[model samples]
Structures are given as structure tokens and as C-alpha cells.
Target chain A: MRAGTLAPGKRIRPLLLVLAARDMGCNLEQRAVLDLACAVEMVHAASLILDDMPSMDNAQMRRGRPTVHREFGEDVAILAAIALLSRAFEVIAIAPGLAALQKSEAIAELSSAVGLQGLVQGQFQDLHEGAQNRSPDAIALTNELKTSVLFRATLQMAAIAADASPLMRQKLSYFAQELGQAFQLLDDLIDGCKHTGKDVHQDKGKSTLVQMLGVEGAERRLRDHLRSADAHLADACHRGVATRHYMHALFNQQLAMFS
Target chain B: MRAGTLAPGKRIRPLLLVLAARDMGCNLEQRAVLDLACAVEMVHAASLILDDMPSMDNAQMRRGRPTVHREFGEDVAILAAIALLSRAFEVIAIAPGLAALQKSEAIAELSSAVGLQGLVQGQFQDLHEGAQNRSPDAIALTNELKTSVLFRATLQMAAIAADASPLMRQKLSYFAQELGQAFQLLDDLIDGCKHTGKDVHQDKGKSTLVQMLGVEGAERRLRDHLRSADAHLADACHRGVATRHYMHALFNQQLAMFS
Candidate 1:
């Protein structure tokens, strides 16, 4: 019954959301913004619980502890995940200090990211695809749905909350997708290079960008995404000194993890 | 995945929601009402899919067909359920021709109905309770949370959509809870009498009212609830001839089913 047992992994999604708000000159600690961050992390945690179920990845360990299903049984794991998803919307709806329309906008943003065309479809593809038979394009699409859509959602929600311009929101959307892919690629590379006490090596046979591109090619791809992320980060908001510094610090830290 | 594979069983929740709106002089065919109905049913169907999984009910049959998990395996069934939940929210958010705040209200209602204090906690209690260990009070609480709460939500959402007065909404809320319990009681009575091709008989040891209070006592309780339901129906909106006629017809039909 305990959710969020995995601690918060990197909190990249929430951090990106806050930084995106900063880019648009919104206060970082606005109660509504903080609520959105909590809601987003709850969703991420819920997804992780489901993903670790015996029916999904069947991982024995996550973050050096037993997976949720392994610890609480599959039934509780699934129900807890469902509860978290529902609670995320509840969090957004009841968040204080936000206009009514803002609550609706954020709710819409989060719900769409988890529906048929987003995480569910992506997880479906991941489950149905033959480990050795998926094409690069299929793999890319799955990445977008399963791992990246929520990433895109957090940034989009922040932009909406800040009332950024439509063009700026679009730029941030692009930035999110690219950043998501780069994050997954680096994760794969880390797993391929060393054990992570989880299912990382078990998925070695599965098609991934890391396998598709090889180390050098994947590095090149990551660089391209990083550049795109930087450019859009600038365009999505003010590109103030703090925003630039924060983006560089986070991205550079992730990059350094490879060494 | 195929979400509506079970052919949308009975449509009772949506029917109750729409009928509630009709009681308040709302046009039954309004797009917003229709979308709300669809969203309610989707949530019900999603709950059923999970309930039928090997990890939960381990059900072999549902609605006279192989259970979703049995037919498509646990992986697809889980993902499909998740998709349906998300889709329900999406339907509420994007339901055409509704005021923005109305959409937000419905979204909040539905989410809260499914979260830790609503369906999820109810379900957790159901799964965790030993067949013979639950008390009548505990059973009643579980029934309220797991079944009545969602029924309550449907009526509440309908009221919100129709812009009904607070007193009217409260009356409808009471009506919905009584109807939900009555429905579940009748269902249990039917299960006791004959096989429904589902897991009804399999739960003989479970703490249903029929088991806790004998068949005769349970029948009395059901009738009492029907009376309460009629009273709430009168108080909730107005007792127009059509509304009274509709309520009488529905109750008689349900009562006749028991006979």
C-alpha cells in the first residue's frame, strides 16, 4: 500500500517543469506550481509500480529494493498505481492559489499524456514487440509514448500554468521530447555498460536506441538532442542567466554520468 | 488494445447519471451529459478488467466471455485497463460543448471517486479481508466506498453539469447511494440463487450482507433502501409526473427481478 517507495529518481520531470516556469518569469515556489510537481511525481511513481509488476517488466529489484509487486503482491501494486493516477488529478484540481481555468488546463495536460495515444499505447508496443525484431522507427515511437510523453507533459503543464505564449509553449514541447529521448538513451547506455541491480541487462536483447546507434552514434544523437534542448530552452521563455545556468548544470550532470 | 470488448455491461451507472439530469429538467441528449455517461461507463469497465485479472479475481469468465486477461493475457489486460481510466478523464476534459469549469468539476469528481478514499481503498479492503473475518460495519463501509461512491459521483457530476441547487444535489447524492446498495444487494441475491457465469458463487465466504444478515433480513434491507431511494427521488429535483413515473418503473423492475 506504500507508494513512492523508490524515493524520487532524479526528479527530472518536476525540476524541468520548475525551470520552465522560471524561463517564463514565473515564481518558482507558487503553490500551484508546487502542487503540479507533486502531482507529476505521483504519476511517475505510479507508472513505475505498474511497470515493475510481474505482468510488465517483472523486475526483481528497483533502486536496490524489492519491486512493489514483489513486496506488496501484484494486486496491491496495480491498485496503488491506479490510486496514484487518480490522486494526481485530485492534486491539480484542489491546488490552492490557481485560477479555475488553470486547474482545468493542467488536468487536461496530464490526462492526455497517459491515455490511449500516449503511455498505454507505448507500453502496449513494448510488450507486443519481439525483442529482436523491432525497427528503429517503432522503437523511437515507443520511446516517445512510454518514457517521453510524460516528460513532455510536465513541461507543457508548466508553460500552461505560467501563461507563456503559444509559440513558446510549442518550443518547450519540442524541447521536452528531445530531452526525454536523450534521457532514455543515456539510461540505456549506463545499463549496457554496468549492472544497475534491476532489469537493465535483462533487456539487452530488446531493441533500444543504444543498440541501434552504438556508443559513438548514440553519443552523436545525444549531442544533437542537447543542442535542440538548449535552443528551445532559450526560445521557450526568457533564457535568463539563472535558467541557462540551471539547464547547463542539469544536462552536464547527466552527460557526466556516462563517464 | 480492445477496450470495450465486453460489450458495455448494463450501462447502469450512466443511466443513473442521465436519469438524475432528466429529473432536474436537463435535456437527456446534451453532448455534455452523453460524454459524462460514456466516461462513467468507461471507468466501470476499466475496474472490471482489473478485477477479472489472475492477480485479482482470477476470473475465468466475464459477461459470458473469456475474461480480458484470459483472452489477451495479463499484459494487455492491465494496459487496456489503464488506457480506459485515462480515456475516461480525456473524455471528461474534451467533452464538446461544456463550460470549462464544468469540465474541471466533472474531472475532479471522477478522479476523487477512484482515488485512495474511493474505489481503490474499497477494493483494497475487499481483497485483503478474509472471507469470514469482516464485520457488518466493515462490510457496509467497503460497499459504500467500492460501489456507492462511484454511483454517488455520477449523480454529483450530473448535478454539476445541470447546475442544480446544492440541496437538490445533496438529495440526489443520498438517492444514488441507496440505489447503489440496492443494486449490489439484488446482485448478491441473484448470485446466491443461480450462476451468473462469473465469480459470484465463488465468493460464498465473503462478507456480503446476504451472508452477514440472512436472506430474509437482506431482502428487508433492500426494500428499505428502495423506500429511501423513492423519498430522495422526490426531494432531489421535483416530483413531476414523468420523474415519479420513471422512478416507480425502475424500482418495480428491480423488485420484480428479485421475485
Candidate 2:
């Protein structure tokens, strides 16, 4: 579990959670925020381990290292993934300073994001439909399930922690939806380029937005999503300069590789 | 998930939870008790799916049918297991009439039972050390991890639901521990018998109490455990006549097969 989670990688989901919590004016202790953040990251890490299994994506490398199953054997890897997932809920269930209702709500959100309506469904779709000729709507729905559900869960958990107004939570939900699409599109673009130090051509045979739109068209769609995401973020957190700046820098660093 | 969980089975863990809750005078709605019971059964079903995988026990049959992976492929089987586990937590989190603190405590107990200190650790030990020359104490610890931890969690969750006194909770804990040990030993004994209608000889090469003590000696130990468990149950629930009757019938049914 440590090897899969603590290895050097961009903890984008947890960072998004922390930033959103701060943007929502969450006044909880830093420890509470950090624990929630870690919980989100643990879920992400667990997904990656399962995804890289021989029966799933069959990827041999992750984070520039042997995948968990490759390093630890499949049984241990599966157990580690489960351990991480269970520990994630355990962390939130016992997190200090949060109200019982808040913790319960957070656990509900996180578990749903990992269950039938989220990662499991997303992965099932990817495995069963990636090579098939799929409609744009189908592909987008898959992307939403694979990426945005967790993003929505992350921000919604932040909203719960902060006791944000319903309207603010709605805006953040929109923001997460748009940002998650843009991020996945950006990843698709990166997968096609050889100079990005990533595992290139991962989507070589898959039906993706980039496959339908080409690199330039995909880039245009990505920009549209980013613009929409920024608008929602602005509406949700007018004074969230740090969040805006960090998102801007991160996207620019990846998008610039295309230029 | 449905195929794995809703299949015909004994559902001993969930039954234990329901019985314990009733014995503790839990006055929550029947739906709440049913939901909690289903959650425990879901967790048990999820563990069985993983344990039957090709990378683990390599078992081809479960509950008298082709194992999940054999029927649905390993990837789908894995996702189904995870979905079951996640849904278990979700059920508890959203269970009606449960106070937020009660929900949180139940989630903590259930998660720990599935995580490092519970199922994962127990499965790991079984996979890594099952065939080794382990000491009696080490073997007992493994049995406790694989069996008793969830039993303890089930009863503790019931205690929390009923708001039982700490003294009553302690007695239930002791009751669950002894019951769980006896339950595991009985399973081992049945595994060695050819006429039990079970998938016999599962522990043919594993280091088990039955292996160390022989069938008669193991039966003696099981009797001791059952006696101790009854004593604890008597202490825990003086008026739990229904629970005691059910346990007595279940055990007699299994043990009679040997006679």
C-alpha cells in the first residue's frame, strides 16, 4: 500500500480536495483537511493498483516503476488495494473535528464514487467498449464516470466539510465536472506524444475523443472545458486566487507540450 | 455482485449480527437491522470472491457453483468484489434511524474488519504461511484474524446500535470470539469429511488445528470452544433464548454429519 500510494506522483485528486475545501472557507483544523486529502489519495492509489493488474489494463509500469502486482504478486496487490480502500474510509470515519453527519456524508460520497456508479462502472465500460465504435456521448459519459465522479466526490466532500451553501456546492460540482473532462482530454493528448516522459500510445487502439477529433480538435474542446471550469470556479470561489493559479500552472505545463 | 452475494448460502456472519442486535435490545426499525445484516453479508461475499480468484486459492467452485472469476472473468470478478465491499460501507452510512455517531462507529468497525488488522492481514497470512510449519499460537492468531475479527466487528456494531452497556458489550465480544473459533474449527473438520456436501479437502496441505491435533482431538477442542462460547453467550444475553436455539441447531446440524 505504501509503495503504491507514497511513491512520487502528482496527487491531483487530494490537492483538488484541499484547494476546494480552502476555497469553500472550510475552518476545520489542518489535520482534518489533511486526513481527508489522504483518504482521497488512498482511493486513487487503490484504483491505480487494480487498473494495472494483469486482468485489467495489463500495464507493467506505473509512476515509472513496476506496477504493484508486478512487484508484490497479484494476491498481495489485490489485498493491498482493498486495504488502502478500507483504510481510506476508516480515516474519514474517525477523522477529528468533523461532525458525525459530515463524516457519514463524506463516506457515502467516497464509497459511491468507488462503487457501481463510479470507478467500477467506468472500468467495466472501458474494458468492454474501448475498442468498439462508440458514439461521442457514450465516450463522454465514460469519461465522466472514469474521471469526474471522483472529482465531484472530492469537491462535494469539501462542501460537506465546510458546510457550504447548496448554491456554492452546485457551482463547485459544475467546476469539478468541467475540470475533470479537461484533465482527461489533456491526458489523452499526452498519451499520443513521445516527448512527455509518460507511457505514450496507451490509447493507441482505444476509442477516445482524440481519436475522433484529432489532436488539434481535441485541444480546442479541452480549451472550451477549461474556460467553462474557470467560469464555474470563479462563481464558486471569487477569491480563490491560489486555486486558480495552481490549476492554471498545472494545465499550462501539460498543454504546452503540444506547442 | 448480485450473483456472488444473493446466492444460496448460510449467511452466518450476518445472522450473527442480527441475533446479537436483537439480543442487545436494538429497537431500530427492521429495515435498519436488515440493511446492517446485508452489509455484513456483502463483506463476506466480497471476501469469498477474492479468495476464490485464480491468484489466491485457485478454487473453481464456491457455494456449489463455478467461482465468480471462472464464470465472469477475473477483471469483472475483481470489480464485483470491490463493488460489494464499497456498497457495504455505503449501506451502513445511509442506513436510516442510525445516529451519525452510530453510523460512523459502525463504518469504523466494518472498515477495520476488512482492512489491515482484519481480512487483508488474515488472507495474506493464509496465502504466505498456510503451508508453513507454524506454531499453534501462530495458527490460532491466523484463525482469529480470518474469522473472529469480523465476528467481533459484527457484534460490536450491534452493541453500538443498541447502545448496550460496556459490560454487556464486553461479554458479547467474548462470546463472538469463542463462537468464531468454534465456527472455524468446525469448518476445518467438515472440510476433511467426504459426506458433508461441502467442497471437502480444502485444507489438505494447509497447517490447521485439525492437522496438528487429528480429527478427534480437533473435535474435542471445538467442543471446548463451543462450551466456552455458550457460557459467554449466557453471560451476555440471559434472555437470548432464540439466538441460543439457532446456534445450537446450526452447530448440531453440522456436527451430526460427522457422527
Q: Score the docking of each candidate (DockQ).
A: 0.78, 0.93
Q: On residues A1-259, what C-alpha lDDT tens digit does candidate 1 reach at each position? A: 3545345367777777777777687787687888888788888888788888887788888766788888888988899999999988888877776777788778778888987778888777877783857787777788888867898889888887788888888887888888777777677777764445556574666888878788888878877877887777777667554555766787678667666
Cα distance off (Å), candidate 1, residue A30: 1.7
Question: Candidate 2 residues B165-236, lDDT tens each?
Answer: 899889988988888889889988888777543357878789999899988998899899999988888888
Best by the DockQ measure: 2
For model 2, state the Cα shift of residue A114 in Å: 0.5
- Per-residue lDDT of candidate 1, residues B50-70 (tens digit): 888787778888776788888
> Of the candidates shown, which would achieve the greatest lDDT relative to the real structure?
2
Predicted model with the maximum TM-score: 2
Chain B alone, TM-score, model 1: 0.92
Worst 10 residues of 2 chain B by lDDT: B192-201
Error of 2 at A20 (Å): 1.3
Cα error, candidate 1, residue A13 (Å): 0.8
Each prediction's TM-score against the native?
A: 0.95, 0.97
Each candidate's number of clashing pairs is 0, 0
